[model samples]
Target: MGADERERLFQRARECSGHRRTWSEADRLWTQVIDAYRQAVSGSGRVDPNDRRQLARALWRHGMLLAARGRPAEGLATGREAVTIFEQLNDAAARDATDQGRDEALAELITAVLDLAETAFAAGEPVLRMDLLDRAVAAGLRTAGPPPSAGPRTREAMGTAYHNQATALLHRCLTGTSPDEDAREAALAASRACELRQRLMDPLRPLSVWEMANTYGLYAQCLTLIRDLDRAATVLDLGNRLVELLGPAGAQPALKLRVAATMLARERASARGGTGQRRWGWRRH
Candidate 1:
């Protein structure tokens, strides 16, 4: 195919990726996108940096699709290549610090790493998941620091990155292999994520009920892990409210919140005992 034809096919593939579709359809479109980009790269006598970056993006999308479709081995191989491409772009961007394109490239790199991390976790490779999470956090912090100029989307992505890290930490804690420090780290990361989510909130761009519920639920879980029962209860309540707003689809998470809240309250009560007075209060017989 000519360059123009390849470009047209790529654009169509990108557009198709944006719409809500079944997993099978998404897999097919992403495959087409990857093949188109591969053809374009093969036909070129000398590939330009722009063309290479486009190929990286296509590979990244295809890797994500593969992961979502439960093909982790293929996803891992493709994702690694995407990461290498983005890392080179990151270096180039750093050399020319004024170029906004490098920053965007780094952001996409972080996203790709995170997507692979999810796949790793799903595939029961906890160690790879942690490594990817650490890499993503490092990349995001290095390139997307302090998002006043990074805009709402960047800020939201940062919030998501932090949240993902926190959840990973929480998973570690739950595995019984993590030290006590893991719980503390999880709580801290969760708190940061919560604050970012709150900051990112805009009246014109309200989060989906599912997003709100998941964030709140994850934050509450961290609080519970750290034994901050009161805050956990409050956050859990907030998540439950969002889940309610999500209609019948939210029933499962809402039920989960209810169960977790009840368990947390019970644990707190068991720890506190039946006492009528405060800790400082002078309670007489």
Candidate 2:
């Protein structure tokens, strides 16, 4: 079956299973989607550029996931293929290729770079990660020309790219058997991600609860990983508070779960040490 058909089947399964229940159907479809993408790249001449870009994005994401799940070589190679397609679209000067073609392709390139970075990181190559991220940011500047406006595709893509890069840096630092300097750099990178997300949320005005919660939640988690538990707790609260406002527009269950987990993690961290004092110490001390 085609990717769309596979997606339809997955969605149907989800709908039948009730959105709340765990179902492997979606996972199966996504797997098929990634497989299809890889196959297309082998004979990419038949695929249209726009379709190639979308499929490339899918392949990159799934490849990273597979890498994280322990197929680093396959995942990294898939990411590399996707990166090539993203570069082509980014070089395009037409809307047929990008919704905001100029910046969209750039955003795609940024995304591809981030994927490559993560895949490389998983494969134990920090130097590769750093190099890809550097190119991602530079290419992003060319394609992502302006700050985000409501519904502006490029802006969101840019924000996503920034968040991805920062998160990769966070993982690289946290998981390494490394020196303090490396950890410190990772913390700083995560902080930059937090700041950029804050700005992205602000301009949209009356930001949705989901958006606020996710942004703050990621910051909280990053802070927690860096041993800044107190700041993490505060950010976790901010994220929870936004849930009420976000109720109307609907929210993503996955992000909601992350928010929940962050709150639990904060409490756990607070309880571990001189509980009450650490709760408010990071900012002051």
Candidate 3:
């Protein structure tokens, strides 16, 4: 197909991919999107920055879907491709931008790193995951700068990145040799994420459903790792309430699963506690 036709197809695929759908439908649409992107790139005589960005985004989404569908190796390859493209774009932007531009480039770089880290975690590459997380944290600090001037969207993205990193650390704490050190570090990262998310949505609004599901569940897991069952129970209760607010079963299957896991953890904590029951006395609705 021609470049214009390919772009149109990519757009349609992106729109289709965003809607609620069965895995088969999602997989088909995402594959189509990737195909369109590849066609456009091949048709272009010269590299187009916008086309590269679209392709990177498509690849990243496809990689996430692949990981979700239990194809981690292929997903990791696609995710790495996306990250490499994003990094190249950021490097180019870094060469041309001023202070604000620099911040934006750094933020984008941080995001790309975190995205790869998450993919690595899904691929069972814990060593690479931790290394990427460390790099992301460093990039995030630079993105924030002296006065902390990142926009709300950037801040939210960074917060979510921290949460993902923290979750990886928490997993290590659960399964690794140095539980105490890993737990402490995980708690610190989780707390930072929690604070940022709270700042993003507090008093006037609550976290977006996915953010609520992820942040609270992961934070509670960190608490559980630290043997703070009471606080973990409280966090799980908060997450459970978010699940109740979801209004229907299967509206967000992944989020529901996370919430369910949080509930199970709370129940286990309750069983092991001194009082022989949940401290919060909260039951899943």
Candidate 4:
């Protein structure tokens, strides 16, 4: 098929994938899109950079669809392929003497890595999830550059990556064998996330406010884990204030913030030598 034809197919697949009812058709169209790209590459005896990018995009969408449709393992494999292609593209972009498209390529790479990490998490592969999240964070940092210099998209992606890393670490800490080490790492990740979100904050954007508040809650939880009771309390207070800004919409996060506050208070009491209290004994949400 021609490039135009393949693009039309991909667009159709994208539209279909956006809705729940047409997912099966979307899957079929994505397969045709991939097949067309493969045929074109095979006939030419080489892969065009744009073609590789389009193929990777198709694979990424298909992987997400599969995962949403209850085929997580298959989705994970497909997502891995997509991430590999994006990684290759990123490496090539880094090598280009002209310095063309490097940031765009890195952004895409970070996105693919994060998406694949989510698939891995859904597939119950925490180790792979953590590794991919770490890669996403690294790529995000490269894309973001120095403070106040990164574009809005770059900052948002970096914040998301850090928040996800912190959340994943905390989950592993709660469920796995290593609590102390993971909690410390989680604290660091959450701190970065909070910093990025702070830069991104705007009172006009309710979603941004909500995200910052949620991140604050997560940061407080991390602080509590590390026995930083005073800091946790302060963070929780900030989170609660953000929640108040949301009015009724913040009810759920407000409850979570309250719980975090209680946990912090308990930790403080324990720090003062309260008996029969477990250190780092916050309930897992």
Candidate 5:
């Protein structure tokens, strides 16, 4: 078949993959899609960047589906392959001196890296996950540019990358061997996540508000871990305010903020050699 036929197969696979009920069909279609691309390359005796990108995209989606279907090890392997392809494409784009191609490839690379990081995390490789997240953050920054100049898609990708990085760092701080360093790094990541999400927030978008509130809670948790009680309190307050503004849609972040507030109070109490009161009053409606 031709490139157009291959693309149609890819689209069919994507559509099948969109819902859980059709995942088995998706898996079948993806295999066909992958084979089609490989056949094209073998027959042509040369690699096409566009073909490689489509292959990588297919691998990424297939990996996620595999993970969702309880085959995480396979998912991780596939995701790594996808990331490798995306990285190569991104590097080639960088050397080509075309801003459009470079940016597009960088965006794709960041997404692939981030997805692979999540797969690694799920596969119980926290260190590997963190490394991939760091790569994603770097790529996201380059693609996103300054906050003022970034388009919505770039801003969203950057915000997600920062948010995931901060969450991973915080998890390491709470559970890994390097509490101090992880907490500090988490604070930085959480701060950037908050900044990016803040810029994206709109009162009309409850999901955006919720995301901002959750980032605030993460920031507060990082601050509390570092014993920065004052700043933690401030961050918690900001989260709570956003929750209040969001009403019932904000319940998840509200709970997160409350937990962070509680942690902050405990830290303060430890510092003062006394039981800390609930000084950060959460108003009830």
Candidate 6:
């Protein structure tokens, strides 16, 4: 295609890819961009780094839609591909050129990795989730560039890691020989993440942070597991109160119910000849 045609095609693909109203449309646009790049290779003549970046972005969106729709494995595969291509293009960019391109690429990779972690944990593949979380946390903390600050996204990523870890531990608790120690550690991390979120959310304080409530509840959950009913009750009580203050009405009924059930379960466990609390040494982080 001529220069005019190529530019138009690229612009059209971008517009299509960015339309978030429908997932199917996003997929269609991403497919077109992918097809456009398929005919051109690294040394196959005139190549645009911008075009390469766009293609990666398209694939990222398409993969996101897939994951949202419950096709996590497919989403993860596509996201990995996008991360690979973007990393390449980002590195290939001239130093004279703005690092915005590289920053954007890395940001997309972070997102994809986080999504993959959540999905893996949900699917009971905690190993995969843990690996992704490890990479994300390390990168988030160590990110150094012209941008100076790691940005709010880094905190968000860390929060997500903690959330997924808590979930994986909970899954293990019900499905395996939980061993106490494992559950305690996960719960402690979850609580620390909640504290971090509170500090980060301070600017929006009074706006109410339901996510924080949820995080705090994770610690309460761990306490419940170890027969620390009083502490567990206190933590969850505060969390439920925050949930109420958030004014989401029905955003967390199920979670609240689960907490309530846990409280009742703790009571039953205590009544059933259970003595001596088990401190799995799961120090609250």
Q: Which lDDT tens digits does candidate 1 get at residues 59-79?
A: 887777677667887888888
The residue-level lDDT of candidate 4 at 237 comes to 88
Among these predicted structures, which one has the highest TM-score?
4
**What is candidate 1's CA lDDT for residue 162?**
78
Displacement of residue 67 (Cα, Å) in model 3 is 2.5
What tens-digit string does per-residue lDDT give for candidate 6 at 1-285? 443554566567556645556556656656765676654444568877666766676666667666766777887788778767755653564244355644554555566667667766555577887787766555545553322254454455566666656766665665567547766767676675766667666526643376677676676776677566677777776677676776665266337536644654655565575665543333231
Error of 6 at 133 (Å): 2.4
Compose the digit string of candidate 3's lDDT tens values, residues 1-285: 566876776666666556656555767877877777776677638877777777888888778777777887888898888878777776776687665665665666677778778778778888998998887777666645422366555576678777877878877866788878988889788878877776676533434565765677777767766667678778767767766665564245346346546555666766778556433333224
What TM-scores do the predictions have? 0.79, 0.56, 0.70, 0.84, 0.81, 0.69
Top lDDT prediction, candidate number: 4
Quickly count the clashes in candidate 3.
Answer: 0
lDDT of 2 by residue, 1-85 (tens): 5657645543453453343233344345556665665565556366655457656766676566567567777778878878887
Selected candidate, larger lDDT, 2 vs 6: 6
Tens-digit lDDT track of model 4 for 136-251: 98776665565356556667777888999999998998888988899999999999999989989999999889989999999998898888877998899899899989999887
Model 3: lDDT to the true structure: 0.70
TM-score of 3: 0.70
lDDT of candidate 4 vs native? 0.85
lDDT winner, 3 or 4: 4
RMSD after Cα superposition, model 3: 5.7
What's the lDDT of the predicted structure labeled candidate 6? 0.62
CA-only RMSD, every prediction: 6.6, 7.5, 5.7, 3.1, 4.7, 6.0
Best of the two (1, 6) by lDDT: 1
